[model samples]
Target: MDSTKEKIFRCAIDLFNDKGVSHVTLRDIAEKVGISIGNLAYHFKNKDYIIAEAFGRMEEEKMNILSGVQQIPSFENINNQVEPLLNISKKYRFFFLDTVQILKSYPAIKHKHQAYVENSIRYVKAVLDYSVGSGNMSPEPEDDKGLYWRVATTAWMHLYFWPAEVAIRGKSDPDIGEVKKMMWGVIKPYLTEKGIHNFETIKKEMYASA
Candidate 1:
């Protein structure tokens, strides 16, 4: 939380986004922060330690974003959820892409990656539970089908990562509106009749606001 520590984390995140994690070293972060490696070490013990801290910071930011949505009164409104996710994609586009790329190299960070996946699943499950409880969904209590839908929806949202990385490579930026439409198609069949109506109403409100 110290200003210097925050600077180091931001510098490390930028470097990791520009260069793959495997290619980044503590020296790179230290140089970026304009601090000595020894000084950096005074805050973080090693490269892995710094990487873990960076990931923790990312998780914290994500939780904060989710918390903002959780405070919204209407869980049945898809826009209330989707909008924050789009905001997250826009703000942390590079971070998410870099994290996915790092995850592909599972052999190097197997345990860390597994922990991240498990934590992500738990976070998503909590959101799904909230949605169901708040009348956004009609899933049977703790049913496997309900669980599957939640997990699948989470994966569907992750599709944004592909377009985000592509845009980084000079391809077209992702259209968040189109992404919402596609996601709605995938989510519609799972919703109850009331849920469907609520979804449509939310969609109309979203468009009207736009």
Candidate 2:
């Protein structure tokens, strides 16, 4: 069962994603949740408080998806991660669409956002390392510190822009499932034959599960 605070948090994400952060206020969230202003204030005193909680909820959802993965992650494992993350990203589209403005408005968000960025980099590095360990990738320079950072940084750049790209080109909101497919291009060049084989397997699994 959701507590009043949890309901408010979810309601705020919907409101913010629909009307955008800049256009939303505490009263709007309170009204959407069918709670009085005083009741809402009893939980989240301000808009920033609700926004931060919403971001925390995203992190928690990601953690739940990852928790089901194998110990030594693989290309297959990464597919498990990316698809759900994309869904969550699309669900909270306003956060990405208006990210810059939110950051500028609430400078404190940068700290938590940086944490998410670093976590993503770490996951990318782990996948690379696991590939080399499993003989699915070249044992040479691919896992070297410089190369690892370069690839992860570039990969994250693509993932980060998924929604921003849609907004920038004034493109129709493509289906999230198809948008997730574009991630394959991000890391495809570096993959070995074995890596590609494993990735294809994961792709099939994603299709079956979908």
lDDT of 2 by residue, 1-210 (tens): 999998998898888887889888888988889999999999999988887877777777765665444364766666667767777778788888887888788878878887877876776767667777787766557346477667767776666678778777887664555544666666676678888787787677656655
Pairs clashing within candidate 1:
none
lDDT, residue 72, candidate 1: 58
Once superposed on the true structure, which residue ranges of model 2 sit more than 4 Å away at CA? Answer: 64-70, 140-145, 170-173, 203-210
Worst lDDT run of 10 residues, candidate 2, spans: 63-72
Residue 129, model 2, lDDT: 70
lDDT of 1 by residue, 103-126 (tens): 565435556655655655555556
Query: Global CA lDDT of candidate 2, please?
Result: 0.75
lDDT scores of the candidates, listed in order: 0.63, 0.75
Model 1 gets an lDDT of 0.63
TM-score of 2: 0.82
